[model samples]
Target chain A: MSVQPGPATALSMSSATPAIEAVELSKRYGEVQALDGLSIAVAPGTVFGLLGPNGAGKSTAVKILTTLARPDSGSATVAGIDVLRRPDAVRRAIGVVTQRSGVDPVATGRENLQLIGRIHGMRGGEIKARTAELLDRFELTEHADRPARTYSGGMQRKLDVAMGLIHRPQVLFLDEPTTGLDPEARSQMWQEISRLTGAEGLSILLTTHYLEEADQLAAELAIVDRGRIVAAGTPEQLKAGLRGDAIVVELADEVATAKAATALRAVPGAREITADGHTARARVDAGASALPAVLAGLEQAGVLVASATVARPSLDDVYLRHAGRAFAAAHEQEVA
Target chain B: MTTMVSHSGYLTVRAVRALVRQPVFLIITLMQPIIWLLLFGQLFSKVVEIPGFESTGSYLDYLTPGVVVMTALFSSGWSGMGFILDMERGVMDRLLSSPVRRGAMISGPLAYQAVTTVIQSVVIFVVGWLAGARFPGGLVGIVVTIVAAILLASALASFSNALALLLRSQESVIGVAQLLVLPLVFLSSAVMDIRVAPEWIQTVSTYNPVDWAATASRIVLSADPDWYEVLWRLGGLLAVAVVVGWLATRAFRTYQRAA
Candidate 1:
């Protein structure tokens, strides 16, 4: 089989550049500002993950970039076409796997592919051949003739991705692709996505609330909050750029939190002290070395220490520093 | 050598194939017209002496054409319910996300409804024939009547689907559809002739495309074929179909814009 040319091929030969770019894009739905002057650029042949809690406008951003929805203000270009002005061209250049899977449950898996291919103006033979290939790619060759409703959740999500890839678009937008899948299914989907991106060298923009999925799949990610981007960087950089490993010191009494924060600030290599309930967390250069001093400082201040643990800085830590709350805690609040 | 066959009729063929897949639905589509024929045919048969009524041999003959047209209207009016299902199920969104032309998306479902209308029309005609409504015009007349019913029904379905797009709510679309259909059927000469009806009713029927469709179909099916009447009624229905279809196009544009 012939390999699909990626961004590198075009870049190496000429001046073709970023596949998708949003310059301070904004969109509002009545009273709710879904996206607030968000800006990001995705290089050709790269996976750019939009990571945020639910209702953080990650899906909104994807919708604008894929040309399904337009931004109220600001400009977006996808695959060299203005999203709002030339949506038809943008539609031609990109494939979208929406948060809601769009596969027809009544139609057979193969029929679904053929139907999509035909709509894309593929000839009968071409659509048939491509349908066979997509079925094989998603490992649905056996179930190709069966109605899609009969497939497992993982199988359906896989087919969703395969459908997007059928036309070999320059850019692909996957909005929460593995959202409802079990861990095993999610992992399988991750592998498939990785293999396809690598093989075809396609630029992908994926929005996922799963932090680790962002870390594992995206070379770079933008952490979004409310209706704007809070931070943007590689997963390693975002984690490494934090002051230190998070050391959580739960005080014996809730009142010690404020006192402990004051006391911990004086300790060497500690930064960004925040107290919540009975727990006082501080970022330090080395949690192991700083723990004894932290304990000593708290003792001097007559603060009772109940528990203490030191660990490597994670995306959760970065999120906490940026958003003023733990990632999981913020996610729960959003869900509530 | 897999030479492609660009079936000019492929769109309609695919539409029929899709409609047939839903067997329960197909049966329901066929039954609505049959029910109207049986119920209204018997009721209006005895009440035909209300003066000014053209003496038809039986009420069934007068009602058959109207029932066929009403069935088409009823079937067409609910075409958008499928669209709502498509929307909720993500199938419609998937199609939009593809490189498919906007017209084709509208055509697929509309074509399917048209084909279903034809099948239902055929079933109604056969039942009417078995009930002693002799076809004086033979095969040509039957074919013309069926074609008129399909076109008129498909056109109405297109407009309804467009309204469905505008409303974007299944309950609202279905409610509005139900409210509009019964009135349109009643106001037209579907159950009784204009001559026997009150003056106000005759004036209102002039504006009802369902009346136009029924009149056209009845003209062709009746023993005395008034070519002028048939042509004029068919033309009026065609015009309504064009206008309603245009509204649907505007609805499509509105839907895409909002999305």
Candidate 2:
């Protein structure tokens, strides 16, 4: 009979505002359909991830939204400004740390930050203070005076993130921020990115292929595939929506996929079974209890099994369920 | 307007800082002008004795302005390299995404080369003086030489940056610019006296922008201070620089879509 009112006040203050929104955004690069009917809405002051494999139009969407490239069709708005109509205003309201490190390698980290600050029309004293604050926060204060090329990959990436914040933009886009970093560096970047979530009216639109990264950082996210949003929701909601355990079967050969799915479906409480390219996945009520029955049904159908696994539902399983293929395989296909 | 000016200032400062960080670049930049002044200056010392060649007190004075222009040519040839580096490093995309004036980005690298060319021209002039070169117009001639070098460097720098933005590849830009500059240098009076050069070469030199700079500076330093010729040639170099600089700014559109 009652509802939470305190948090709703904060949201209601600007209920009409979506920090970034795209509607049926489509782009074709020569023959490649980089983005097709891609759409998303990001809440203000939250980290929103565009989670997808490489070449899934994640970067394309970002390029359009950032005004670096134009979509063949469709429209978008960033920070309440229409990207297509007033790109310069959108540019001023956002900061971007692209997949590639954007720090000027030849200039000192301080110089790189100062350049962006000046570009944003910050006064000299303001740029100096902001640059100093960012360097200290990013742990680059010790090496702030050195050419960014001399810094390690992690350091340079941190500098890039800092550079993006030089103007205190309303929105920040980190496109695959941890792509080229080592594990240690990736986690460090993750920590740095995590610190910026949910504060100061600053919203973030992070594009990443790492499942865990999206899970850890974004409060809500969209799974893009073939330039379309396959699924979009809170991480937990998306995973929870795929109710039941994921039973993965590793097959010896690409054979009898339809037969295997039929057999798994015959088992009680098994649903949404699929056999694709030496792998069969099924959903069951209880992984431990349903495993033996599913296996027996497959064996009855004379389907040879290399191995099988029963695990809790995950984004990977959700992606598999929706896309009818593994995410890694689709990514590989794009790369090839 | 203030944002544009400040952004331009910041970008120029950033470019200069990059050059300062690389001490070897400064040394290598000087090497071209020094070599022309010392080796080429001495090797061609007897050119003054040619029947039509005016008797400049020494060959160094005759070669000083040419070497200065050549140095500007060589340095400006790689002006596009800075844009290539920024693109490769993703810095240009970062700037493009910001509110910075796009023209400021184009002019930053060009201004760095222009400043370096002027400063190096002074060094080349001092070296020429020590090596027995005589300046007929004294300080005015040195100022004219620096101004000429600045214009030449600015024009070449704009052309190189335009190529960088248009081609978006470092290797192609280097190959094209180097090829283009060689012909321009050979056709001009940078090395040989125009009178001693073939008649076609002499005629071509008159129309060459590089020759405009060389002639403007050479006249200022020669005993015959032909104000009209110097002013017109200097005006020509400035006009070319402005046109090429405007083209360089327009090239940013290609870059924006390129990403």
Winning candidate number (TM-score): 2
Q: Pick the candidate with the highest DockQ.
A: 2
DockQ of 1: 0.44
DockQ of each model vs. true complex: 0.44, 0.72
How much is the TM-score of the A chain of model 2?
Answer: 0.92
Candidate 2, CAPRI quality class derived from DockQ:
medium
Which residue pairs clash within candidate 2?
none
lDDT of 1 by residue, A24-140 (tens): 988898888889999998877789999888888888888778766778899988887898898878877888898888987767798777766665667878888888888987899
CA error at residue A268 for candidate 1, angstroms? 6.8
The local lDDT score (0 to 100) that residue A45 gets in candidate 1 is 75
lDDT (Cα atoms) of all candidates against the true structure: 0.81, 0.86
For B1-259, candidate 1 gives per-residue lDDT tens digits of 1111222133345456566676888888777777777776766677667767664557787777788888888878888887787788776677676656667666667667766777787898898878766667777788888778877887878877887898878886687568988899889877778777778989999988888877777778777888998888888877877888888888988887787
Give the poorly placed runs of model 1, Cα more than 4 Å off. Answer: A1-11, A14-16, A249-270, A274-280, A292-308, B1-15
In model 2, what lDDT does residue A215 have? 92
Interface RMSD of each: 2.6, 1.2
